[model samples]
Target: MAKYKAPLRDMRFVLNEVFEADKLWAAMPATQEVTPDLVDAILEEGAKVTENELFPLNRTGDEEGCQFSDGDVTTPAGFKDAYNLMAESGWMGLGGNPEMGGQGMPKMLTVLFEEMLYSANASFALYPALNSGAALCLDNHADEAMKEQLLPAMYEGRWLGTMCLTEPHSGTDLGLIRTKAEPNADGSYKVSGTKIFITGGEHDLCDNIIHLVLAKLPDAPAGSRGISLFMVPKFLINEDGSLGERNPAFCGSIEHKMGIKGSATCVMNFDGAQGWMIGEPNKGLACMFTMMNYERLSIGIQGLGLGEVAYQSAMDFAQERIQSRAPGGAKYPEKAADNILVHPDVRRMALNVRAFNEAGRAFASYVAMQLDTSKYHEDEATRKKAAALVALLTPVAKSYLTDRGLDCTITAQQIYGGQGYIREWGAEQYVRDARIAQIYEGTNGIQALDLMGRKVVSNNGEYLKLFAQDIQDFIESNSDNAAVQPYLEKLGASLETLMQVTGNVITRAKDNPAEVGAASQNYLDLFGLVTYAYLWARMVAVAAPKAEADTSGFYSAKVKVANYFFARILPEAAALAAQVNAGADTLMDLEEELFYGE
Candidate 1:
């Protein structure tokens, strides 16, 4: 595979030009200190660390995987050293709260840096990614005493964090979780149960691991309502902030997975581990969502990052690897045959990947900007509006980006033909690594259901309407600009289609609950398509005028990609709409036994 290079230029385009993130940052009091120069410096430094330190370890880390012996877990060679460097450089707390020893960067800035980390080494990225989510959860929900006790070391990276929600029998359904937390003479509880598929559950990269686990009290009610969140440390901490006796949480084993081999996926057994409750009793899932929602977006970036590297690597291959002559006839007659890129189909595949990656970057930044607004905006009403939009789009970001991510990786791998299958080329590793993003952080299917069932239908599409208005407002403001008129018209139509389908589903669901589930995935696809159309239109608006005067092909390429997205990709919305309107009858008609197929 080609050497991984951070897409700093494209990142800048998304943050500075497309989103005008600096202006937004300046307007918010919390982000007022974040100037354009500081953001640029952060981006440059982030690119260097991810490219120089993390990229070198990716192949070797995947090759080495993680080691497990007895109760201890060991990460791939060089991982500990790299983690230490990130920690010492204060990179771990790049987005943590300022009062908690963090650098207090906005989500808009951190998401771009996260993309670099995932692009360079997804396996290694999991360690810090999980830490950030866990830290966010603690900062948001835990009281001041707990924050003082935990946030400092966690932000400093001396102690890392993990979210333990799934078990062998229960994955998505929190109500069925059998983990039991018994109250002690002291305020703490004894958390005892086995949790599986715990990422960073037990790794050698940090001095201690803080697990935000879900459990139930003996007298609690049944189902999800009874669940409570707890903070279980691998090694207990003394009152003076020094290390104390070892906690009962132990790594029973680690899974040998298809990809992300460098990241340890462990089976953890909390054998009467001393854990403190994070929030009110039976409100665990609500508190844990603070982290889950964070992970959902991070997982989306996992897909975006992998898709980007895959595209670049495939393009690199296309430059050197010659195959048949071009369809128009030998473009490179000086060589034995034209490069594979001369083939229209190859270009199609490359363009497909590029369109999604660029749009995904913009989409992620859009969501991050909402997160910033929800958190830092002084006006209560504005914060509520931004928070609602964040909730509405979080699922789309997680599901759509990942779904396209897997497709992009496969397409990139196909560019290599037989060479792509070989492990040495590195394309196959990307495909393997990208696969899990869709499955974890609430599977794409679940995300769609959440979008259709909860975020949209639960409120009668109020949140979605709020989002639609934002796009509609943009279209109205730019209706007169001839250069962007075509894009605005198309975007307006797509927005109309999305609103129609959404209203149809909401009406249909009143009679048949199954309609929501049946329409969910397709509805999500339609929503995602329209959302990308809006972003592409905005990108074109910014790049159209600059393309004519710019010496670099950046603006021109951006315009071309936007055109491709509108002309070629946006049409998929129609097909998704049709599928969403197909109703649940066809799906529910088959008998349960028929599905088994005698």
Candidate 2:
């Protein structure tokens, strides 16, 4: 409802204290060139850009929306200006590799900036976020010629990018996609199909729109194994690296959405468009994953940022809005009513949001740090370990952050009561915005299935065990920090419960096909809470010593939230644990005739 402010100081603390990202960056040769001063400088600049440039355009952009007509789409008023400002300031390429046109900032820091961008305006954030993901795929898979041709302009925001994957009848069921790519005499492919729910699908803000469309070759295998990724630009690129003529790829129509109204979710029709294959034939999913991985984390942070802003907005309102008296007594004898802050339940709800938003920030940055380690670190073992970490945590980051994003936003909305239900209050918008985060980018349920089925159970709990060992090691080493000991202990207990539950689910599901699917959502939530609990303890341990010597109340706040998380939130895992153990019989046993009170 109110203006958003970047939580710069809190972000800085998490990066330095909880993650010690600078030290990790200093060790990585690729990131060694990045200095703390540079990270700080960029953070300062990023905060201003996100707050001043992007935040102001949020409401306006939402109201004006994107104008779509006759194969053309125009961004909302002031969006083009805000985008160009981002372009000129080099914000678009903050963490882009220096080899291309990016500033080569650490991914650790970029995650925080991306959070700010999302918090400021999620609808507006889609353009650049998708661009960055497109750039990531190109940088990794495209040959030198393609990278040389596309990276600079995209990094500079002169050209934008879109991902075309979903077909009318296919989304989660990508195996059913009907898009096709036929080989051409020019060594390019003629891509033909319709893609729905394509973000950044069409816009006049850039000189060109680069599309990463997935299509199947004629000789390819059935299902997802057949899909291939192709680059289909709206305008044919000239040999001299200039714009030629309009290509066959164009917007068929745009979907009206519940939130992120400013973003153009278009139905893209690629009709015999000349497109270059991005990766090896039939390896499209992997290539697209390069971008999906980035997008997944970016989307997760979207929820995180919105949660932070919503929580902050709610806290501000709670402190100022005078309403009912304290339940026990009249605290404000001279006033007409007491502030809502006096209500214990309201405080509990507000504190829960704070706990997740802050801890979620640490968790996200920590994962980003792992990304940098996996990519830039020279040590083979470190890279391997970090890679494993990424595989283990990516789904969690996507699902958990957004799950909490929804929960925290709801809590913030609860603080507003009736006002939150009405659109005018803006609290409802955060809830709407947060909802998609759960559904899109591989639904949270899918994320949970990935974590439990692939990451945990498939490897026979190797990643699960390794990761828990890492956290347990931290707890053992830092047991001396009295302030965080209890939370750390609870995390240790939760980890044990998770392992036991994971093993039990795998064992029980061996006999029943539906068992795993039935318990997956609850299992993921349980896993996420444990992960956050560990991050919370890590935060408290780092902040306790820092707070002991400093005058600032930041660390004290950290300690309080960690405690609150343990006392108020972590107990839900017990309920989730019980539900996960119940198996599928309760859900699947009921006959179809039972519906309609049969």
Candidate 3:
């Protein structure tokens, strides 16, 4: 396996330089206490933990997988100690509410650390990732007493958290779930159901496992309207804040999976498990959505982190593995043959991965910045605008990042040739791990539909206009910068194309609802491509001037990647535009019965 190293320089460049996160932090009251030195220390220590602790366990965990006997699940060796180290260091609650025991770090900084965790060991990362999501849900919906009791222990790492939503019969359709929640004599309720694919469902790493489960009450209406969220713990908590006897919830079995083997995906049986209602009755879906949104972004980061690791490993291999001589001449004449880096095809693969990874980093940071603004901005109008932007881009961030992440991982694996397929190199693991990101968190297709249906069509293109206007504003501001003029023009053209496509989709959907579904995936891709273009332009605007004056080549590399993205990658927006414009005729004309002939 290739040794994992955190990409701190690129991360710092995105955080401190590209986004000017420090300035944003200083301006926000919530983040004013987050000093530059504190951010640096967090990143440095996070890097050490991921590289030294988690990376060592990644391959071994994959090989060993998890062991389940009876209702208990045991994680792979080294996971317990590493998890403890992470929790003891307060990494689990980096973004938790400060009023609780959390460090209260901003998402902009925590996101960088999250990428490192995902890069080091995706399986190990899932544990804390789920905890963070659960914590966010509780912070938002749980009552003060519930918060006072649960948040502190979870933030302090004495407990871990899980989100239990998926059941055997239902995946994307939460309304189809069969979990049952019944009121007891006390205020607490009894939750009973079988939930599958529950990550960290029954792990042994912490003292207690808190499950934020979704179920329906007896008096509730049918379908999604009836669902309610509950907080079910593995060990019932006493009023004195101490652990009591084990609850009825048990892991019937653990799954055997393609990747992330160290993370226990289990079949949890909540046999009349004692649980407390989180929000109001029959509002469980809404409560769970708060966590789902958080998880969706986190899962997207899972792809980004794995992609970075794959790129690093591939780049390292290309520099050392000698193959056929260069097309022009032998670059390493003294050696038997030139390195693979001398080939255009090899460079193409590397650059493609680099382009996507770097853009993904920027895009994630942008979303994080919006999250910070929405939460901390003093002006109500500013907060509403930030919140709108977050809603508009959350689906894009989740779908586009994961889609490109999977592509980058595959390209990176191809760089290894036959060696990439082998387990020793760890290239294939990246591919396997990345595949889930696309499928889970409502799938890329679902994200596309949501983007088109709810965010765009339902709003009558209001959110789309807001995003386009932001891009136009940036283009106008940089119109005179000779260094970024070409980029500005390309971005401007793409933004116009996106606007036209959005209007077309809205008009067509009015006549035929299927048109929305047909154009969704392609339309989402177009939006994503243009968004990346805008970000690349911003990055180039920052780096190009510095590159021209310096010989260090750091800023020059940024310009090169930006150029490659515009020249090679951004043109895909045109093809996507063509596809979306093709309409739903071809898709709908094909009879459903023909899909599977008798």
lDDT of 1 by residue, 146-214 (tens): 899999899899999999999999999989999999999999999999999999999899899999999
The C-alpha local distance difference test score for the whole of candidate 2 amounts to 0.87
Reference-based lDDT, residue 84, model 2: 84
Runs of candidate 3 exceeding 4 Å displacement: none
The CA lDDT at 317 in model 1 is 93
Residue 562 Cα positional deviation in candidate 2, in Å, after optimal superposition: 1.2
Error of 3 at 478 (Å): 1.1
For residues 1-598, could you state the per-residue lDDT of candidate 3 as single tens digits?
A: 4757898888888898888998998988989999989988999999999999999898999999999988789999999999899888888889999999898999999899999999999999999999999999999999999999999999988898999999999999899999999999999999999999999999889999999999999888989999999999999999999999989999999988888899999999999999999999999999999999989899989999999999999988888899999999988899999999999999899999999999999999999999999999888998898899999999999999999999999999999999999999999999998988998878999999999999999999998888888889888888889999999999999999999998998999999999999999999999999999999998999899889786878899999999999998999999999999999999999778889958
Ranking by lDDT: 1, 3, 2
Candidates 1 and 2 compared by TM-score, better number: 1
RMSD of 1: 0.8
Local accuracy by lDDT, each model:
0.94, 0.87, 0.92
Better of 1 and 2 by lDDT: 1
